[model samples]
Every structure is written in C-alpha cells, then in structure tokens.
Target: MPRLVLEARRIALTVQHGLHGRRRAGSGENFWQYRRFIDGEPANRVDWRRSARDDHLYVREREWEAAHTVWIWPDLSPSMDYASRGQAPKRERALIIAFALAELLVKGGERVGMPEMMRPSANRRIAERMAESVVLAPRLPASLPPPFAPSPLSEIVLLGDFWSPASEVAERIELLAASGAQGHLVQIVDPAEETFPFSGRIEFREPESGDRLTVGRAESWRADYDLKLVEHRARIRAAAERLGWSFTVHRTDRPASELLLALHMRMGAGGTASAAPKGGGRAFVSRGPA
Candidate 1:
C-alpha cells in the first residue's frame, strides 16, 4: 500500500509539470487578468493604480477558486487482477490511477473522495489518506460503487474494465446521472484483451464466475471477438452520451499520463468532455455539458 501511494504521487508530480495554466476570472484572491472597466460598473471595482498607467480605467479579476467535489472509484473486482505477459495487473493500475488522480485534483483546488469509502476532502495528503482507507477497510469495495445521488454540484469518475452486462452498466449509469452530476467513465483494458494474440488451443476463464471455455483454435474467434468488443464499447459510450457524460478508453500498454492529461483538461473545462484525437490505442469522447 505504501509503495502504491509513493508511485501514485510520483506519477501525479510528473503530470503536474506538464499541465498548462488554467486560470480564469472569478472571485478568488489570486489575480487572474485585468480588463478595461465598463461604464456601467461601479467605480469601486476599478483598480486605480492600473488606471493611472493607461487612459482607460481597468478592473482586476481573480481566478475562480471555488472548490468542487469530485468522487472517484476504481473497480477492484477479481477481473481487475488479471494481467497478460507479466504486465502490471489491472487492479494495480486502477488503484494507481485513482490515487494519482486524487492527488492532482486536490492540488488543483478540488475536493476528492471515494464513494462509500472516503468523504470529500481537500487535504494535501489525499492520496496517502485514500490508500490507508482502502487498506483498513473490512472488505474490499464492490465492483460498482453504491448507487446514490451525489450533490448536483459534484462530479463522479468511475475507473474499471466495465465488462459487466450492457443492461446492468446502462442501468447503473442512469441511476447515477439522475442527480444531474457530471460523470466520467474510464475503461481500463489490457492489451491482450484488445488484440487476442493467442493462436493455439487455450482455455479462457471468467474471472468472477470461475467459468471456463476451452477453444481448439483461439485465433478463429478474433474477428467475432473484435466486433463484439467494439459493439460493447459503443453501448457504453452511448449510455454516457445520453446523460451528457464522458467516456474514455485506455489500454494498459499506454502511458497513464495521457489519460490523466485528458481528464484534467475535461474537468478544467467545466466538466465538458470534448472529442480527443485517437492515438496509441486510446480513444476519448466527451459530450456536451448537462
């Protein structure tokens, strides 16, 4: 757990350096920008010192500092424990992303929380606190977060493979979106799951159910498998779009920073997810704000 926390912090720091400034005019203390004072505005709003330098009066604006609450959940189901070719397990990667995202969000003046685990907080040590909570919990969190309506002012982020039945996934999303909170669905997939590189006879096991299927030639199913995968992704994406939420698909082989940067941009843009260029087997789709 300690190691995971440390690694998450490292990744958070790395991404932090690459993030561009997101300053915007608001009621915050920090100066954001200065603009010519309008005639209708009160005289007290003008900055006299700046007006002295120029013929026109100027008004100083401060960056928006309102802290928003964001709930984050990473699936810890049995399936997340699977890894191919000695790659990092999906469970580990999910946890790392969750913790690192918490760190970044807190640093960016947002409150981060885990549904049913941790409450929203802006503590600087948010990542460590979350790790401790996970380790100390009596039992592991469920595959899906408990269904409850969060504050409409809050946003939610769910990270998982999302291999659950399409109906179930759609229903859960509907229940969460009922509260009108913005949401993000991040699908964490293993490279082998996408490629299905096996050719010879192989036995595929269902991680949660312990069901197994033996195939004489696994390569024969590649085309059908790919089609089903694409269809499933489309369904999930459709569900998110219907609710004005965002969906992002990321492969384990890709750098985690890529997803983080995309997510950061979406959140900083007022919870609106925009279409991102596809690259390195990553796909992002952000819908109009609710």
Candidate 2:
C-alpha cells in the first residue's frame, strides 16, 4: 500500500511486459509432461483419460515445483544516501532495482529475501514486506555481506556502491562461494562519483566516516582519481571472476530496466546460475554513460 511498493510494482510490471512470459510448465496447476506409465507408479498420478486414448497407461509428471531462493541485500550505509542533482539517491536506486528484481523473481515462482533481514519465501506479500523493511530499517555501516552461512543452492544478489576495499569484498564473496551459492554483484553509483566533476576549492567528505578534506585545487587530482577508480572497480570485477559470479555496474541516472533486463536474461525464469567468464572478463553490462 505504500507509495514505494506501488511505484516499484508499476516499474516492474512495465518491464515485465517487455519480457517473455515465464509460463513454462512448472509445479503450478499447469500441465507439464505426460509419459508412458511405469510399473510401481502411483495411480493418482496416472492420466486415466489420456491412457484410455492409447493402449499404454500414461503418467503425468508436473514440472519441478521447487523454487530457488534469491537472497538480496541493499547497502543502507550512509554512503549509499549520496545523490547528485536531478538523480535519485544511490540508496533509492538500489532499493528500486532490488524491489523490482524481487517482484520479477517472485512472479516467476522464485523465492526472494534479504539475508539476515528476513527469511526467503515465495509468498505473494514478500515484496511488500521487503519494501516496508527498507523504508523503516535503521542505518547500517558500510560493509560487505556478513559471513553468514546461506543455503548452498540459493542465489545471492547484492546491490551497493561496493566502495569498500577489494580485498574485503573478495573475502566475503569467497566465503559465500565456498558454500556453493551463485551470486550477482550490482555496483550502483552516482554520476558524480564516476565523473568527479568538482573544480577548485572543493570540500570532500567521506559519508561513512564523516572525514572531510578540503582541496585547494580539486581539478589537479582528476587524473589520479580516475585511475584509482578504475583500479578499484577492476579489483571488484576480478573478485567476482575468481568465484564464477556475475558483476555489473549501474548508474543511478540510467534506466533501471536495462540492468534488470540483463539480470533476467542471466538468471531469469528457467535460467540457471550463470558461471564466471572462462577468461575472467567482466560480465556483459553497459559501462555507465561516458
């Protein structure tokens, strides 16, 4: 009933229409497959009418009804609250994508939840519960996913700026991958962060630590800053590659549907967990607009 939930559903539905229907035969009330009945089969599963049409008894097998849990986490740290003019806050963008992805996944009969925040469930109200939590949740420190043990077969989707040290990020991911879970890393950023478009006499502050530094000539550090930014992202990509996970960057300024579509293609309905590139190249994604 909240505005955020309503808006997220609208966005999701709009994108959903552009997407292919995930209506393949599954554990639902829909028909899946029929085959010749074998010995010792349960009579309840036999399609008597179909069997009558042929000499052989036919057994109906419903599609695999088991759904995979997709654990999603959005960074609620102070840094995620950053927003340049005319753009949604990084935190808001993360939530929009997270909620939209949850809607899509749940619609496809997959379960979704936030790690440590709630249990995974395919219940129709799951997205609403998640949206409420995000709206009312307390702030958390800027940190990587906690080293909690998760269902080995469940998938993990993390939405954040990932400004943390690469080593820390790699360790957390390695810990999860060791449990045999597939993952997708979505690095959400503001255009300002990428461009560093500040000029002379700028005061920059670290959102998490409240550390501030005044630079007399901000333009002088542009080259070095850009290089460091590239190196930082590369490390994150490399970490994801080492564990066979998918990594992509999304700018708050771009359409959320673009990244959402890519996600659906990679791990949507009937799509298995994607593997890391054989050559360790970054997974397919449009680099944020130049």
Largest lDDT belongs to which candidate? 1
Worst 10 residues of 2 by lDDT: 281-290
- Screening candidate 2 with a backbone cut-off below 3 angstroms (N, C-alpha, C), the clashing residue pairs are none
Q: Give the Cα error of residue 172 in candidate 2, in Å.
A: 1.0
Model 2 Cα lDDT, one tens digit per residue, 1-290: 36656766777887898676444555655456788878997888789999989999997766445546788888877778888889888777777778888899877767788876777876777668897766566655445776677677778888887777777788888888787788888888777776777789988777766777888998887777766666767777787877778887777777887778778777732223333322222211112211
**Candidate 1 residue spans exceeding 4 A from truth:** 18-67, 268-290
**Residue pairs with clashing backbones, model 1:** 273-286
- TM of each candidate vs. truth: 0.80, 0.80
TM-score of 1: 0.80
Give residue 13's error in model 1 in angstroms. Answer: 1.0
Q: Per-residue lDDT for 37 in model 1?
A: 96
